[model samples]
Target: MSEIPSTDEALANLSMPLLDAMMTQRAIRRVKPDPVDDAIVVKCIELALRAPTGSNGQNWEFIVVKDQRVKDQLGKRYRQPWSIYGALGRRQAANDASMLKILKAVEWQVEHFSEIPVLVIPCLRGGTRVPYVPTPFVGETSYFGSIYPSVQNLLLAARAMGLGASLITMPLWNVTSARKILGLPLSVTPICVVPLGWPRGRYGPTTRKPVQEVVHLDQYGNRGLTP
Candidate 1:
């Protein structure tokens, strides 16, 4: 196991390579309304480019929206599925104690998504999907696999720079309308919308199930040591 920080100061100044970033990243749903600098956005995109892409076909684009009117319009579309998902999470929270915190956070994000400082929509050029098995699910999942590493890289970079970011894909349920708002061509697919800014609170440790539950040895039944 990785060593825990000795104090809050150590945790606050914490920065490391890839694995430590993965260990500390939390979904920062609420962000201050102050706009992020254009230079920072460019830096984040540059870091994203370093991520490995399937077949090295680096086919991606980012649309950064800071205009209030456009944000309002996109937020309107985002709220549809955000509302539905929040309702489901709320209902589940009544019976599942573990879900209560995130349910409330989702509600807050839905209410203030438009007011968040910056909105980033990541897109993929349509024809470059990595080939996968012919099954429909495989095809879709494979397409996303190619794009998400870059998304994650951007988020991790944001955290490393003390910025907050949350990857929201719920808005894509009405993909046609979203594509129209972004003026994306029919061949371009917007993979996810990311909201980013300075966070209202500090980030610290994150919780997860024991590693043994997910990791296994050479064979399927060979669960590693019970942690």
Candidate 2:
């Protein structure tokens, strides 16, 4: 991890109590148009590989994209879902201004998604793994356990390297069309489309529900840790 790249913030974080990268990790959607070096992307992937995958099988791939024409195609497909989900969010969160703010941010993201420097489509290789007998077939939800853990890693790694990134699964909601646009083989499942760049604003801690509110210890509704 020391060999992986770092931002000044990450370097100063060496003395912080918590993992500074994790403590300040934000879902960055708005980003500058600066080009990301290819080596940096590989370094991020290296950190991502540290995450555990199901059955110790590393049957995953990150398709890094930068071609403007291709990004335009993918971004076009990504917008349909954004519109649908945005409408639903507007209806459901109508009374809440904060929720409406999130919808507006998402709208900005979809509109300028392709403008981000890099688009990484995290993938999972579908079907058999040869001699490796995989976990029993489960529902779609069950199967995603292998890829998303690394997705989290990738996000943190990008942040540590001073790159802004966000997980955008809306594009994958229309997997067939997305795969076609990416020229992916049918067996290669595009799980999510992540837009990466240098953030337009400063990096900071995320506002989230306290851990005690979400965690249960030994019994349901029992909060153990004090935040």
The candidate scoring highest on TM-score is 1
What are the per-residue Cα lDDT tens digits for candidate 1 across 1-227?
A: 12222233333443556676788799988777876777777777888888877678787888988989878888888788776777777876787776888877777888898889888888888753455835567666766777899999889878777677888887777889888888999888999988887787765678998788888788877896565
- Cα TM-score per model: 0.85, 0.83
Quote the positional error of residue 60 for candidate 1 in Å. 0.8
Candidate 2's displacement at residue 66, Å, is: 0.6
Instruction: Indicate the worst ten consecutive residues by lDDT in candidate 1.
Output: 1-10
Models, CA RMSD each: 5.8, 5.2
Q: Give candidate 2's error at residue 93 in angstroms.
A: 2.4
Deviating ranges (above 4 Å) for candidate 2: 1-18, 128-142, 223-227
Q: How good is model 1 by TM-score?
A: 0.85
Cα lDDT of model 2 by residue, 83-189, tens digit: 77788999999999988987887788889877888988889987544456665567355558888999998888877677778887887777788888889997898
